[model samples]
Target: MSSSSLEYKLIKENNSTQGISIEGWKIVTKKLPILNSQEIEKVQKEILVPLPEMFFGNNSLSVSNDDYGVLFEFSPIDALKLVDSTKEGGEKVKVAYSEEWTLKSSKNHEHIKDVIKPYDWTYSTLYSGTLKIASKGQKFEKTTERIDIEKLKIPEPILFYDEIMLFEDELADNGTAVLSAKVRVMESGFFILQRFFLRVDDVLFKMNETRVYHEFGTKSLLKEYSSREEHYFKIKAQIPVYKGDDISQLTNPDWVSSKLTNSEELILENLNLLGGNYSKI
Candidate 1:
């Protein structure tokens, strides 16, 4: 028997006063094919139970918390269903699977623990890997680290990107995709706009449509003068590349350059640096 490869994508959605919203970005999964020899070995392993049964059971799933919030949960079955629904004709197949958990704050909440929401999420096929068998069972190793978020002191307006390229195969040569940017605000006040870029492979096609999150810092301050606040902002855009487009055209360019240039021009034209820090992240 031989194995085949598959890909999967994970998405999570939530509802807010502004209506339904989506948090986080996409994640890719690489699946190894199932082979006859592997199937037989799986049966044998089931009989012997060589693996640790404790971690293999429902206990395999759990949640944690930080100053942010409790970890939400995701289900493999739910991801499969989402993929099936979006497929061209709803092709049915046995897909490689996994579970995910995310901890998010409520719309009106400040900290994760205060207004925490737990979600059991799932993703569809993203990517698959090759399967191999070994005569002697392979050894396994694991490591764990724990840290207190409140104990660590970090700056406000923490900027983070989802790192899209790690799951390149999930993207098509001329297909469109969305990248999310999350800005977490701490200590409500004035923060200047800083430089940011998509940081995608040059080979990635140009984005067709782009949407940005409203500058909440300015808006929130106008609404209230409260301190010790946080905001999660997201921006989603559609990549613009058609099937069979030259891959070379998409490769190697400063993705954030144009955006930075535009910001500078906007500031110069307005004569007021209303936003905070123009430094690139």
Candidate 2:
């Protein structure tokens, strides 16, 4: 498909500044899946209503009979399996199996205590923003400014559909599964900066021994501004029909890395270089 056909708008707002941009890019597919119409509809419905709703109101009183909507959503179970190809002519690539799965939220409130107690000294500062998709040929416009995180409350736990699948019949007959969904990006290429900030800090400690920090810090700050990284996250895929092709038979999939070479990094570098402007908490 022509790169011009794929356009996206990205709006990022932090403690510093908010910026929006438009851009064009191509989504080159590798091992694309053949999803049935029903599967596609299921995914769209799940994503659109990531959370369920509950209603609360009085049946009698006219003055205090106010209705309230509450969200109650559960995380879906999904698993992705990578099986080594046994075919003769094909390269040694693994096949992906996606499946519908379930995740049981911990019934034990003590489990939450066990998890959060360790981080008692550490507090969580969540940063969340909306990314809206624009229809093709639609002009870009900024609709909402700042969303108050506190006021924009979720009454129930947040849930996500699983991206991985496993099972035998899922991969039977040369079926392919989706590796990743198309991500909408900013037009001006500033979205990469947003992604970098969101992902890098969370995993910086993992790359510490590799000298990633020193190397990254010393490198021309501006040069790293518009960089993009391809993260290979496993999701639930379909299971092949074969008895031996179950989810447990698969191994970890290799990671894919790509940089947003087309996006500009000058703005990102300036923000990083200018100290004390962007605070963590």
Candidate 3:
């Protein structure tokens, strides 16, 4: 209608990536469409990620450690089995993706990498979601160490991928008990670093670990991820922030903390994980 108004509209369109910003960052979320055969093939070649299974299963039990005030419950619906590298057609690997989880994108978003790797050359897929718990769940003691990599026998992961899982059942005896962030295997499954921040009840802790897949036991270093990973959970939520260009129904970190509640004292407690719990020498 007016000369100045029309000019502004054109400028906005040209700088499309400028997008809508929240906290000085663009946060755009777009709904995805179903994939045809060709599209599915493209996805497979890009990141032959294994089909992710439900996080919590029907047999979820509840347990707690009275001594440590810690708890454990919630059984995973289906364990994410290793990737099937054998391809008869040489086109696709064996993995199962439910129709619902098959398609979604977070393009033009800062919180999560949106683009598929190798094929896209732009972004990465970092998923975030919640694990629903029932009120009628059983309760017991966390008699054993919840995470004992040594206890369980693990087959060397043929797939090149990593996972970072964190849990904080409750703090101050009142908070959302949650298990968040277990990533599915991507096609470019090269070995790398993995870390997790775990909190059972009032206890807050951190874990830094790695599993290197030395190709053929002596593969050149050039073909792998960093042997040592220098990383902390960069995002405050450590879970998905279901605010912008994504739709996996993840927890939002609109506030300073998204651990269900924002408390200054609890934040200090987590410092223990970083050796902040120590006193000056």
Candidate 4:
């Protein structure tokens, strides 16, 4: 593995945190059970939108470079904050059963009202990751650089991999909404994806994905954000007739992703890991 620049060892602690430490980079992941009532209360106060039904408040995954003093983290709370809280934009998607859920929530979840506010019920967010720079002069800047999918396609041994679900909601049995993160470390570098999947039974299916890719020993990393969506009937028609009987495919992110169109895409940033000292490629 050293030949591929991935001389790393597996890291495990307390059965809940695990990852890999390689050369100059360290990747860590944490997964915990659903938040308790008390923990949910605290999060509700901190975030503007209504908390999802199955909030894993303590779940997170992060990548850090000690030499570069760069840390990027993904968590449920921080991602939800990027939702359309104002609702004035008129782009928010409303679940087909919003009215029914609203009525039931008003009667059964009295405490939720204290923090509930108008927001995108779908919980779509463009958050790539939370980046913290402990080193001076290092920062992310606008760039036209993009991730080379062709490079990623090359066969390579995966050194480490993990996926965690941060949160999910049933939308009062009308549909499904979920947020999750997954990461894989290969010989050259690594890739991370934070995805939001939404399916409104008869309304639509949408997916928002934030992808980050970095090559080992490189001075920069590329972050790409993409949004894909399709109307309920449109995507439904694309499902293979032989497998249409498996309704679960409708909620599968990968399936929905392949059927939808790329509505928008952006190279959010090109992070310079060498304190703004890298030569332009």
- Candidate 3 error regions (>4 Å): 1-168, 171-189, 192-195, 200-203, 208-281
Please name the candidate that would achieve the greatest TM-score relative to the true structure.
4
How does each model score on TM-score? 0.19, 0.16, 0.18, 0.85
Model 4 shows how many backbone clashes?
0
* Total colliding residue pairs, candidate 3: 15
- In the range 1-281, model 1's lDDT, one tens digit per residue, is 11212121222222210111112111121122222455445543433212111111111111111211222222222212322233322221111110100222122124323211121111112211111211122211121221223422445533221211111111212122222112222232211211111122221122211111223222111111101100111111222346344443223223322322222111011111122233221
Candidate 4 residue-wise lDDT, 122-168, digit = tens: 66677777886545456678788888889988999888899998889
Candidate 4 TM-score versus the reference: 0.85
Model 4: lDDT of residue 82: 80
Ranking by lDDT: 4, 3, 1, 2
Q: Residue 8 in model 4: shift from native, Å?
A: 1.2
lDDT of 3 at 150: 45
Shift in Å, residue 277, candidate 2: 20
Report lDDT (Cα) of residue 250, candidate 3: 28
Best by lDDT: 4
Clashes of each: 33, 38, 15, 0
lDDT of 1: 0.21
Q: Worst ten-residue run, lDDT, model 2? A: 205-214
Where is the poorest 10-residue window by lDDT in model 3? 265-274
